[model samples]
Target: MKPKNIGIQMTDKALLFINGVPPENLPDTINYSLIACSDGAFHYLKEKGFPLEKLDFISGDFDSHSGKDETIYHEKFIFTPDQNKTDFEKSLEIIKERGYKEVDVYGGSGGEMDHFLGNLTVAFIFKDDLKITFFDDHSHYFFAPNILVLNDVKNKLISLYPFPKAENITTKGLKWSLIKENLEITNRIGTRNFAQENSVTIEFDTGNLVVFIGN
Candidate 1:
């Protein structure tokens, strides 16, 4: 098993960019099976010269992009104007429809705090259906499954946040490990913890758990 969050080296995963802070650098397009960005993220991709031709599609309401660029990329545009869903959520739907199961997301954090939180919400909504991992300059986060094994993460910062509450949680290879403990947003939360070994295993019984691993 390889380290999942520490690197974005998987060739079978889909790559997605949202309308938050642009990534420090773009990942090699060849490493991804498919690549896409929300309409609001297109400007940053264009400004950063991210090889728009490599994108499989760009999906959103198109409010952030209009006129010239829109006309130029007409063939690549996937218009999703549903007011009920966020662009991030809509993009994930499109990705799923295209038969991609795993996605690596950039620009999912570091803009409006609400958007960051909202993105997490959408991620949680699709947690059972898709393997979505969010990447920022600082770290990578994802909704943890019942059993997760993280390799090569010794001495790195690890945080476990309960989406509201989690039950019967157990962890190994953490400096401060939890054994059948419960974490709650309103009560006890786990953050600023460090891995004690090269590999870490987390097991939990119920509720949503978001795990953040430092880059």
Candidate 2:
């Protein structure tokens, strides 16, 4: 769904969204500075009893959304006409324009498989510019490039799946560890690995490898 790496001043938090609002997996409490709604997700929030008054921005092309609720936050709406990008992509642009470095996305899962996979691409697009976590109620996914050391991972399950390809990958502090190995899509994957210690480490020389440490 949406996902992490943490440790920042409490004041410097992230933008939280419900999907179309954009995606993330954030802590329960951290001063949420802004809230966003993407495309049709605006209506999803409304149906679920989200306080529409606190909605700060709405981003997307709005082709799939019914405009009946547009009047609620019309002033906050942003339209990106590019058909190539998804609503989440459109929202991230607004997030960057407003100078936010982190975003936590909720929802955007349990729909179509292609759309869900398309949503995952946002992490690759913004991995260098912004730290975005695409999280639903259950799953947490984050991009791990170069090196990743996760703490507080006592007994959770972790998986290393590459975005097409990753090179010279290595790992430590898990039930199984890799040393200067390679992980490729379809050909080979390191999945169902356990975090044996309190901390787990991963290293890669090139490519985007997403580490999924989940319950």
Candidate 3:
């Protein structure tokens, strides 16, 4: 059976930049969904008047949720008291169980250091089964091994971070080419790279490479 194209939006304990309302193009409809990770995120969504009814379900321990917001969306919320996993991980597990091949995460990186790092690490935990992308107000970050083709990323900032030690890496259409360069995580080898054209290609011979692109 083919995997479902599930879009997972997470509301971590983060500060959102509500710049006069988010664009309508922001995804309001999700085929399978999870919510109530953080009370702050829930409040922001409510303030923006996002469609809460479209969510498949909301799962979270009520530690972060105040009684006020709980009353607002009680019918559609699933209160889970599990303290073992983070809300972000819980949401990913739910999506994976539903057989989603790709998961897009928003509002994951703006909160406390532990939450931000926890959310980022969640990508690796589910990398084999799902393509997870973390998005913030300014950047989109994901890890890809083997070959990655980025189209029309001109004038954008792209950085690569190698994990578990770097291996032979090469780049095409980038300002700097790796050409079998070994980039260790301790060394800031893959930072501040630019795209020379509308498209860019990167290939990693070994190890996981995290690619971050933003303004």
Highest lDDT against the true fold, candidate = 1
Worst 10 residues of 1 by lDDT: 1-10
Cα lDDT listed for each candidate: 0.91, 0.73, 0.65
Better of 2 and 3 by TM-score: 2
Which pairs clash inside model 3?
none
Arranged by TM-score, best first:
1, 2, 3
Q: What digit string (tens of lDDT, one per residue) describes model 3 on residues 32-105?
A: 33322333355566666776554455666656666776787777565656788766676677667765667666
- Return the TM-score for candidate 2, rounded to 2 decimals: 0.83
Flag the better candidate by lDDT, 1 or 2.
1
- The model with the greatest TM-score is 1
Count the clashes in each prediction.
Answer: 0, 11, 0
- Answer with 1 or 3, whichever has the higher lDDT: 1
Candidate 2 residue lDDT tens string, 1-215: 01122553344435556453223333453356667767677766666666676667787776666566666567877877898877778888887777888887776556677776777787688889887776665557688858788999889988898897899988888898889988889788888898999988899998878777785
Model 3 TM-score is: 0.78
